[model samples]
Target: MEHGIVTFLTDYGIDGPALARAVEERGLDGLFLTEHTHIPTSRETPWPNGPDLPRHYSHTLDPFVALGAMAAVTERITLGTAVSLILQHNPIGLAKAVASVDHIAGGRVELGVGPGWNREEMANHGIDPRTRTARMLEHIAAMRAIWENDEAEFHGRFVDFDPIWSWPKPVRVPPVLIGGEGPTVLDRVLSHGDGWMPRRAGLDEIDALAARITELQTRAADAGRGHMLVTVFGVRPDAKELAAYADAGVDGVLFTLPAEGPDTVLPLLDEWAALVA
Candidate 1:
């Protein structure tokens, strides 16, 4: 069994840095926040969580900005974008941001990203939502090239460029956590993601997802790569639920709170901390 409790995902606004610090002060090992460029005024896609997406998603701050502030304040805690909308980003610039944060954190960053849900948001970024999965894969590949090589070039359909140099690299390329749980998403996790995030589900789903990750790890090892991390998001603190996750091979479980300010955030940390201890 692992020794940590959970990571966090929030629509954190102004106080993102303080929220992360509070988590660390409470003895949590990692803190993360979600990213969305802008929430469309016209509601087309149903909110993944409930009847309607909360208003805070529309008012949130940029994830990298929050993570950078959090990194400066905390010593050993890992910081990450709970799920950065990958398809919305320019891969080269996005790669630079990831590397910069990794360097600032002294290598305590985890990357959790998704293909994205809003069609308008993707179109706005000049990315086609239809090919999001493919784009995400190539984006990861391109980033790895930049992170691992002194000068690298990518020529994929979605992300490509001439061999250009980028520097200060990263201490260790931050862990790439693919954020979604479908067959197509799983295949990508098996292929490129260093971890799988089974976000927002029942305890039953946790067990099954963990099994799938373990199975994928076996397959990956056979393929000569090690793709063995399973980081579940929005965990509830029932011992049975967590034990179930551990039995299923989960590396970590991150919880979701309705908000991230001290009011909603602090007490929950105290409550969740004792469970892991």
Candidate 2:
């Protein structure tokens, strides 16, 4: 079980470098940061998780910039974007940013991506919300091409770019984890993503979740690929819950940390460290 944690950091929270150092010292695998380029105020799309949108959604820091700062300060702990909204940014530029951070982190970066749920938020980036899934897949393919080939190009309905040279190529291509839940998510992960990152509640039906994972792993084996990683996000830091996940063959569980100052955040980190230990 690779134990990790993700924190939604506000401006007033412990800065990225300090947070990274604190986690690394505790021997945690990594620290993930969440992103929201900007949250539109129109409220055109209903909040997916609750009655109200959380304040962190509107004020979170740029994951790439924060990860870069974290990378400079910490050597062992990995850094990642828990779920970057791929549909909200130009894939070419986003690819560059990811590679740059991976380089800075010495190859310790996980690129977790999602087709965002907010219609108005997608519109802000000139993306049609309805076409987001298709666009997200193409964007990922285009980014992979950029990372793998010396001179890469991709032409697709949503993302089209000519052969071009981009540099400071990543020390290693970062693993792409697809984040979502539904009947089709596993198929998508098998097709492109290196792993699956489902929110905790998505796995509430344990029997079905286990069966799905088994089926997905079988599919991966048939396709001549290694087993797909099952990582559950926002897991409560409880022993029995974690043991259940481990028993279910989950590769990792990411605990959520409050976006607060070190005074509040550090104690939680200590608790998480002991939990994982």
Candidate 3:
């Protein structure tokens, strides 16, 4: 099994280019960046982890642009968005950005997507929280059509577009990992996404997590989706925890890096490198 790291990059935090270089140099599987266009002011939606959302949510840099910068400085290491909020983006434009990044990185891109948790945030992008799941599915389908075809079009209740052209259609259609632990998420992954990224906080036990993956795999088999991989995120930086995930048949375990400058982050990265070593 492979393991990766996800980090929130900001103007005030880690050196993105340097960290990417080290990730490749150290032989880590991949480095995924987190995203948030902007955090809305309304407090209608409480933070998923706690009562108050962390400051990093508002300060996180745009993953696509940041990852593009990282791609310009390094190669070999997989660079990806841990979970892009697709429900808030224009699918066509987002597709172009994704394709551009994938082309720049020579196909080392993973498009992990989610219909975010913040109602106020979704409202800022004119996305109704209630229909976000439907919109997200349509958004992904539309992006796929754009990625795999010269002349593409997608018609759905949430996303309806006529024939259009998008250039630099990725070196390869990047693998998509759907993020969330909703009741219908497995179905969505089997339908459109190439993998599933479930946060560790959502599953109560490793045994249960393994059971869920077994069920997903069985369902995927029934649906003729044999390539549906599993990557568990927000995992503790403990070897025992990682070993349990590996035993659970998780394809990858994503560790969260602290939001800090290189002086702080590099040492942490080195620590992680040694842990994996």
lDDT of 3 by residue, 1-277 (tens): 7878898887788778888887888778889988888997776787877897888889988899888888898878888888999888899999999999999999999988888888888888887889988898899999999999999999999888999999999999989999988787888888889999998843348888888899889988887767578987778778888888888889988889888887887787778788888
Q: Whose TM-score is higher: candidate 1's or candidate 3's?
A: 3
Overall lDDT per candidate, in order of appearance: 0.77, 0.86, 0.86
- After superposition, which runs of candidate 3 have C-alpha atoms over 4 Å from their true positions? 201-204
Candidate 1 steric clashes: 1
Q: Tens digits of per-residue lDDT for model 2 on 1-277?
A: 8888888877877887888999999988888888888888887688877889988888788889989888999888778877888778888898999999999889999888889888888888888888999899888999999999999999999888799898778899888889998889998999989999888843366667677778889999999999788877888898888887887888888899898899998999899899888
Q: Which residue segments of model 2 deviate by more than 4 Å?
A: 202-204
- TM-score of predicted model 1? 0.92
Q: Which stretches of candidate 1 lie over 4 Å from their true place?
A: 1-14
Worst 10 residues of 1 by lDDT: 1-10
| Cα RMSD for candidates in order | 2.2, 1.3, 1.5
